[model samples]
Target chain A: MVKITYISHAGEARLVEAASGQSAMEAAVHHNIAGIDGDCGGVIACGTCHVHVDGTWTDRLAPPGEKERDMLAYIDNARPNSRLCCQIVLGEELDGLVLHLPIAQH
Target chain B: MDIAVSDIERARSIPLDKIDVSAPDLYLRDAAHPYFARLRNEAPVHYCRESLYGPYWSVTKFNDIVEIDTNHKVFSSDASVGSFVLDDTTLNPVEGGIYLPNFLGMDPPKHDIHRQTVSPIVAPQNLANLEGLIRQRTRGVLDGLPVGVPFNWVDRVSIELTTMMLATLFDFPFDERRKLTRWSDVVTTRPGDGVVDSWEQRNQELYECAAYFQRLWAERAAAAPRPDLISMLAHSPAMRTMSPEEFLGTLALLIVGGNDTTRNSMSGGVLAHHLFPAEWSRVKADRALIPNMVSEIIRWQTPIAHMRRTALADFEFRGQHIRKGDKVVMWYLSGNRDDSVIDRPFDFVADRPRARHHLSFGFGIHRCLGNRLAELQLRILWEEVFERFSAIEVVGTPVRIPSNLVRGYADLPVVVHA
Candidate 1:
């Protein structure tokens, strides 16, 4: 399991152990973490799975996909770190990762 | 100089020409193009003058139709005006019995009130409140999909997501979730010979659910304040005193909208990717473009093809005179592909800068009440698609819907490789 942290817009820090190979969305959701909603079952169809990554991790991860990026643009509170958790696949190499949850998701 | 004859001049007061182009009963799935072009240029608002519905005006141009749909006061949605979907001789006896109330069918004060009833439930806070639960719900559906198997993605995923979401919103029993979805599909799966068979039995379906909702409302109304749709409808300012019939109408609207609209979008999103594998690659390489792609996909595949309106008063638009009480069909399938507005209107662009401007959600006072929900569902869906499936290569030819009013695929088979 990889150690994943979620930072809410209010800056509340919550840490959870996410399974290796599971998307960051699964980790936040598996731990019942607040603020990440993969509403379309990771089909990248619903924007509810939005989360922002730390600047450090944001650059390290693969950029958001065309569909993901397009969706983020429509998000009400998108940010530079804005990432759909479902798009972030967890792996052993990246044991330490952080995502910031927006205050709301439309 | 010769002027075209008014369909009314031929014989029927209501004109029979519209049947060829606007019949909701007849399937126009693979209609020839020259006829459409003629409809577009020669008679943008001319009566079909041939097929089932007869002589009803077909609004073919982009801005022209949008203008009409936006001004709901002048163009009434009352079924008395005309049922939004067309009707044709192809309809059989059983086709006459099935019924459903989509929000698109309601007009004005009633429409406004019905929409407002659940407006708060879809508010940003409400979505935020359900974030964790939604994520869990999505994960559960994904987990249930049979891996390494080529199943109907539309059934397994698209319908499944929205069905569960509807159940959660209503706080219905999870066991009965699929039932609601099935009933909803029967109501709005587009008119077809195959679908027509099942739709014949849909009234019984509605009556059955009406009883269930009646009981749920009673139980929930007695309980403490809650956030589910049932609780909201019980205490909502706009809906608290609604008659049982009106309540059922709104409930049916929510279910139909929540089910069919998003499912079409889900299937469309995948189809766009397959049709344009390069953009799919760009998405695979850089996922941030998913949102833009979603909007473009909606634009590309206008799931809800056209909404019919009845002229309340005599009005002339674009030099064409329309009579009061005339049936006017808003051809959105044509509008979305309008050349004047969207460049290369036929091609799917992943990073379209003005994707949101598309009129799929419609425009004006009666615009889509669930636009936000549809977008939310799609955003999450793309995120998931980017996560689980490496690609969605079409495995077989998709079966497009036959109804002129609903432009979508009845079945889209795709191979999903992990």
Candidate 2:
């Protein structure tokens, strides 16, 4: 199980374990994590499941694709590290990824 | 079964040219006909030849709408596809002209900038701030209805709550709030080309409304400062440089977004109580079920139905090639009812633990900014509706919007068992 930690905008940190190959959002969603809507159902349509990947682990993950980047540009909490978790399929390379969530998913 | 691609393609879009707008059973129900369900089952990405908006794909089924919503670059929400619904009027191709007066009609980057100006004000904190006012206003609106009498709840409750909320957001006089309501309806109404309130009427109202806002801005800019959304926009650095068109557009977005979506949900809630008395009893028995009840109503109503999206590039969904600039309508109303995702998609179950899963607020960056507010309004209105009158019943049939985009009611005659 790959444990993914999330620090909410209010600084509360929670942990979820993804069965390797599940997206971080899918893991968070199955456990009923707050603030991760994934309204488009793991599709990149809605930016509700956005998160900030830790800078240290940025290089480990694939860069946001053109579609993801264009979508991210419209998100409420879009930062330099912003990524739609739906776009990130969980795998072995990402063993312990830490993501920060926006105060709310718009 | 063969796909209806040929028929859909030949028409360019769903043609509503001969739509029976006045037919009782025709305009009402989830879909216009069994044809829609057939399209959903057979060709989820079927196109129709609409009287307005021209040839566009009617994305039925739950999963596909979510798919299109997820891939924004492929299914863009720019102005080209026509923002509202397909009508003889909405299809009138304007020359390099952007339709509607809000940011909902724009593409990504530009939508981002305008969305930012007022986004902060609708955040959780702000919603929390407005909760008290919302409850008071909601109660007042409900109180106005004659308890134990049967009348159109949509008119008395839904429209009232929407107008009152808009008044709170704009911090404007309640009496004039109806003007914003009227203008929003006029703007979003999808009639044939140059139909409804003529462009002359729209332009005149737009100018007057903008001038009113400008005057309010100057007064607020000079007088005692406050913390309303309008003041926030007036003092916003980004708004300071916005062109008149952008200003009008953003304001129109806020007005329409805050108004129509919530009103439909409000009416939907009442209609839900009438349609499924069992669900009503479930909530009434356990008052704590109000929150989930609000969500269920939103899901069932799908206030904002299919949003118009223009394809930015060539793409394919389920093996059908979609060329660049093709109009794609992501019908959230159909997607919210996706059977695979939501158990008993058609049933109104308040206790569905995941009651909040509905795409009523839309998805992604364009999700309803005032969703929390909309929920708050519904929550309070239901609490009051249930509290003030216990055994309410629908004495007559419910009326729905004539347009395609707003899947809600014009009126729902209900008897409040006071």
For each candidate in turn, give its C-alpha RMSD to the true structure in angstroms.
13.5, 5.4
Q: Which parts of model 1 are misplaced by more than 4 Å? A: A1-106, B1-19, B23-37, B87-95, B98-104, B143-148, B189-192, B196-200
For candidate 1, give the DockQ. 0.06
Q: Write the per-residue lDDT of candidate 1 for residues B1-418, one digit (tens) a residue.
A: 0112443242233333433555443233334223444566566776655555556777877777767865666787765455665552211123454334434566755665666666667767676676677667677777676666677878878878888888988999988798787766555543444564544355566668788899999998889869888998898776778776666666767787677778888888887888788888887778888777888888887887777778899998878788898878787777777777778877889998657657676655455657777777787777777788777777876676666655666677877777
Q: Which stretches in model 2 have alpha-carbon errors above 4 Å?
A: A4-18, A50-68, A77-102, B1-25, B28-33, B50-53, B80-101, B190-203, B221-226, B312-315, B319-325
Highest-lDDT candidate = 2
Tens digit of lDDT per residue, candidate 2, span B361-398? 77655767777777777888888877887777878756
The top-ranked prediction according to DockQ is 2
What's the residue-level lDDT of B3 in candidate 1?
Answer: 17
**Would you list the C-alpha lDDT of every candidate in the order shown?**
0.70, 0.71
Lowest lDDT 10-mer window, candidate 2 chain B? B17-26
lDDT of 2 by residue, A1-106 (tens): 7878888888889887889888887888897788887766666766778898887877788898876776787666578888999877888778778899887776
Alpha-carbon error at B109 in model 1, in Å?
2.7
TM-score of each: 0.71, 0.83
